[model samples]
Target: MKKKTTIYDIAAKLGLTAATVSRALNNNTKISFNTRKLVLETALEMNYEQNKLALALKSGKSYNVGVIVPRIDSNFFSSVIRGIEEELYPKGYHVIICQTHNQENIENEKINSLVNVQVDGILMSISNANLEANKGLNKLLKNKKTPLVFFDRKKDIKGISSVTIDDFKGGYDATKHLLDQGCKRIAHLSNDRNFEIFRNRYLGYRQALLDNGIEFDESLVIETQSNVQDGRRAARLLLDMEAPPDAIFSSSDFAALGAIQEIKESGFNIPEDMCVVGFSNEPFTRFMELTTISTVDQFPLDMGRKAAQVFLEEVGHTEDVKTTQNIVLTPELIVRRSSSKK
Candidate 1:
């Protein structure tokens, strides 16, 4: 096996002390610039890799952060991650990403694992399955004094910071847009009510209907997963009704697409016969050029940036002083062809 180079090897090669090599490698301002440059060049020549664990032990910080999301493939989550990385990378922090697949057990395991590895902080979007109070996760973080920031999907736990868009307003805006387009009977494709984001969105939908003097019918609402198949099934159910809905306000873009597909297959003219609105403003929404489906822009990138900032602030404080911040970004409703019946 090949031997790995170390700071000691660099020091020996450069005829310098190990302490000087270490300080130079860490970019300590105490070390002279010329000496630091020489040590760096020597370290590079010897292929020396600084031991992160040793530095973490000395500095009391791993300089590594863990990020947990339901799924990395989703555009919203991916963009949020990108924004987080963009903000933290320049601040000398490394991010480790974990996906939970929307399972609570997996989310718990990931949290425990990241804490065990001595990460400085954790940023997460709690899974749909984590509907209950995350007492266990909270206890673990509190014990470790690790800063935790929740983005998008969040649990209502004290001493934890969270960054999210106003989902209730997003839902309200989407539904109101449909109502303004003269959609008297609007069906809603909702997700599990256990999640606050989905629940708030449903509330917004109901409120909009009431405000517009339209009766809210339970039959017009369908609980569905945010996927094309579920959206298709939900749309079919609505279409099969004795009096089908004239519009749909979906909680997710993928479901809205599915609904659109089902509506077209049923020979319904969009906006004329059935209007639709989806959330998240996914890229494909515009490409498909389906009737401009009104959508809520959650500004996932900004969500990520703010979540990272919260983590930084929490970690910056002393362990004895814990500060929590709840940041809610405003959601913007983008009017598009899908819901423009006028």
Candidate 2:
């Protein structure tokens, strides 16, 4: 393999001291714009790659942000990431993204790794709510070297800022809408047992039924992995019951779409034999004409940008107040052919 380029090599070629080269590379205010430009050009010509770890050790400002999400392919998380980038990029921050695949161990490991790397801050949506270690998490908050922010999928931890939607309200509204459509018997497709968000959703569903004078049937509630196949399987089991559900509320669009496929295959009609409502409002949800109530619109981007902004503020580049803010955006319920009884 070719030798990796270093700042010393660039300094040598440009006839400048290593310290000058480093400061120029870091955009120090003392360096004139022209000198900085020259150093940057020479560094690029020599294929120089700055040692980020060493620089972080010296400056205390990494200019690097870490973002963790349950999964990246989903529309909700990705949008939040995009929002994060939009807010941070202009301020000369770079983001490192890690996906946990909904595993607590993996998520913990990733957070540790980011901490070790000396990232200025972290904006994370946890993989599994059950994986939160208060000791470990509190250490991060108290470190004073790095700040942490949570968005979506956040644990109910005090002193940590989080940006999330009212998941309970979303769930209640989705269920209430189906109930309003005269869905006498309703079922819910829930996610894993470890996720608090899904648990809250299930709670909302039960509460809506109780408020509407509908009996809460434990038999109608199904829990599965947050994926299409699990959704399809859950739908099959529900459909096979002696008395099938009149409506189904899924916490995930992926599962809702999967259930829809299975329902159609089982010779059931949409909105007639069974009404389907999904969450997340993913792109496919609209294309497939599935009724959905999704929270956190392009929220990944907003989450990412806001997280980055927090880091910047923490480091004193900006006077953004360090408030333990809990921002909850309302979710919109989109009605479509799937849920309309008319």
lDDT of 1 by residue, 1-342 (tens): 999998878888889999998888877889999999898888778887777778788899898999999999888999999999999985668999999898777878898899888888889898853544555476665596777888999888777789999999999999998888888999999998888999999999999999989999999999999999999999999999999999999999999989998999999988789999999988888777546566889999999999999988887678678688999999999888888878
- The candidate 2 region of ten consecutive residues with least summed lDDT is 290-299
Clashes of 2: 14
Q: Can you tell me which runs of candidate 1 are displaced by over 4 Å?
A: 1-51, 128-144, 289-292
Q: Write the per-residue lDDT of candidate 2 for residues 1-342, one digit (tens) a residue.
A: 999877778778888898898889887879999999998888778787777667667776777889898789888888878888888864557889999886667776887888998777888887655533534455576675677788877777766777777778878988998998899999999886466678878888899999999989999999877688988999999999999999999888888888888998999888889998888778777776444323223244555566656656556644355557677766777777788886
Clashes of each: 6, 14
How accurate locally, in lDDT, is each candidate? 0.88, 0.78
The root-mean-square deviation over C-alpha atoms between each candidate and the true structure, in angstroms, is 4.1, 5.2
Estimate the TM-score of every prediction.
0.85, 0.78
